[model samples]
Target: MTNDAVLHTEGLTRRFGGLVANNNIAIQIHRGQLHAVLGPNGAGKSTMINLLSGDLRPSTGHIFFDGQDISGFSADRRSRMGIGRSYQKTNIFPTFTVFENCRLAAQSREPHPARIFSNALSYRTVCEAAERAIELAGLAHRAQRHANTLSHGEQRQLEVAMVLATSPNVLLLDEPLAGMGAEESARMVELLQRITPDHGILLVEHDMDAVFAVAKVVTVMVNGEVLESGSPEQIRGSAQVQVAYLGAEDEHHG
Candidate 1:
């Protein structure tokens, strides 16, 4: 493992019965870089994330984080090791206030989350971390509002804040911009761009415009395989990428 690499996979494969969701995949995510995994539906994007986060076990291969093998670790263990993920769906507590949700996530990272109940309302560190996360997600104004009361875009931002509360080194964002209006998507893009300088982000998104705008490196996956990996400009111009994934729409947008 190199010092710069935050996450590395070697020959990663996952099979469900006779179907192969991911096949012989190998990739490297460097520290403080925004990387994108681009592919059409059924390209094994979600499956790969499941494997990396230990939500699903790989049939074969190894996963390394910070130079340590983590193939056998659980998702919670991974999070504790500074690997955080935001789901495609909003995963915040609907009944909890935005600040409460963030506080819970931050507390989970502490040595004793149960103790948080004693003085959660007044705990300085927890309150401060929650405040920072809410602010980072642009939800500081809604801190006292119930999570379910927020707009869909705000809900998504809350989910990102929940992940941020964990103080992760690598953030695995699964479709952060999905289901948003143009304005909301633009806001998310701006927020994401601001955060990328501080965290290593691996984004899986269908929005070509957002992907190209934020990614320093883009890896194209097709039919459960990585077809090519390159800079955004290289990916835009690659004939293989065009044929396998980009197609005419991607070209026109590029």
Candidate 2:
């Protein structure tokens, strides 16, 4: 593993009965870089993130985070170790106000996340962290509104903010721009670019345009295997990539 790598996977594999969801995959994410995983549906992108986040144990192989072996850690444990994730689907408390949601997530980063009735409002540090998250996610104006009331894009942003509240050094973003208008997607790209200087982001997205625009390094996966990893320019020009993944439509758009 490279000293600069914050996350590393070695021969990672996951199997469900007869189905091999992930097959001997190896990945490395350098600290403070935006690494993108691109593939078609059912190419095991989500499965890969799940393994990295400790949501699922690998059938074989190991995972390391910040130079620590974390293959056996639980999801919660991984979160405490600076691994945070934003789901492809919006995962936020629907009834909770935006501020309340952020506060709750921020509180989870604390040693105690289940301290009910402890008056999180009185915890200046938690409150301040929540406020910063809200501002970063561009939800400060809607901080008082319920999470479900926000538009699809705003909800996605809130989910990201909620994850950020955990103060993670490495963030796993599963399709951060999944459901959004073009304008919303543009705004999300801008937001992601702004946050890159502060954290390492591993992104799983289908939007080739967005992937090409934001990612300094792109990993192309096909049929549960990584076909190539390179800079956007190299990927765009590679004959193997064009034959294996980037079809004619992708070239036309480019």
Candidate 3:
């Protein structure tokens, strides 16, 4: 593993009965880098993310986080260990104020639960963390508004803020730009770039433009295995990638 790697996997494989979903997938997420994973449907991209997030145990392999082998850790355990994840769906509480949603996320990191009689927001640390996260996500102005009132783009940003509240060093984001219009997609791309310097990000996205714009490295998968992994420039120039993924899209449009 690289010294700066915040998370890495070695020979990660997952099987479901007779089917192999992910095969010998070894990837690395280093600090201050954005690694984007691209694959056709059924390429096992989601499975790889699930395995890294501890949502599913790998059939064979190892996951290391911050230099510790945590393959056996549960999802909750991984979250507490500074691995934060955002789903493909928006997971915020609709009725809560934006601030409240982030505050609750920050509160989850409290080592000791506050007394039941005490107010949840009265915890200074949690409140401050929440405030910082909202600002980082560019939602400070909307902090007092209810979550349901925000646009779809803002809601997605809120979810990321909630994850940020957990103080994670690694962020696993699944298709954050899904369903966004051109403007929303641009903002989301900007947000991803802004946050990349501070976290090791593993982004699974279908938007080729956004991925190429923000990813420091790109890994392409096909038929449950990696076809190529390289910088955006290298990926764009690869004949293998074009034949397997990129050119297929072009041919379809043609």
Scored by lDDT, the top model is: 3
- Each candidate structure's TM-score, on Cα atoms with residue i matched to residue i, is 0.93, 0.93, 0.92
- Where is model 2 more than 4 Å wrong at Cα? 111-117, 248-254
Which tens-of-lDDT digit does each residue in 1-254 have in candidate 3?
45457899989999999889999998989999999999998999989989999999999999999889999999999999899998878989999999999998998899456488888877999999999999877789999999999999889888888998998889999887887768767877887898899999999999998999999999999987989999999999999999999999989889
- Model 1 RMSD, rounded to 1 decimal: 2.1
lDDT of 1 by residue, 9-67 (tens): 98999999999999999988877789999998899999998898888999999999988
- Candidates' C-alpha lDDT: 0.88, 0.88, 0.91
How many steric clashes between backbone atoms does each model show? 0, 0, 0
RMSD each, Å: 2.1, 2.0, 1.9
Clashing pairs in 2: none
lDDT of 2 by residue, 24-63 (tens): 8888887668999988788899999999998899999899
Output the lDDT of residue 58, model 3: 97
Error of 2 at 87 (Å): 0.3
Prediction 1 TM-score vs. true: 0.93
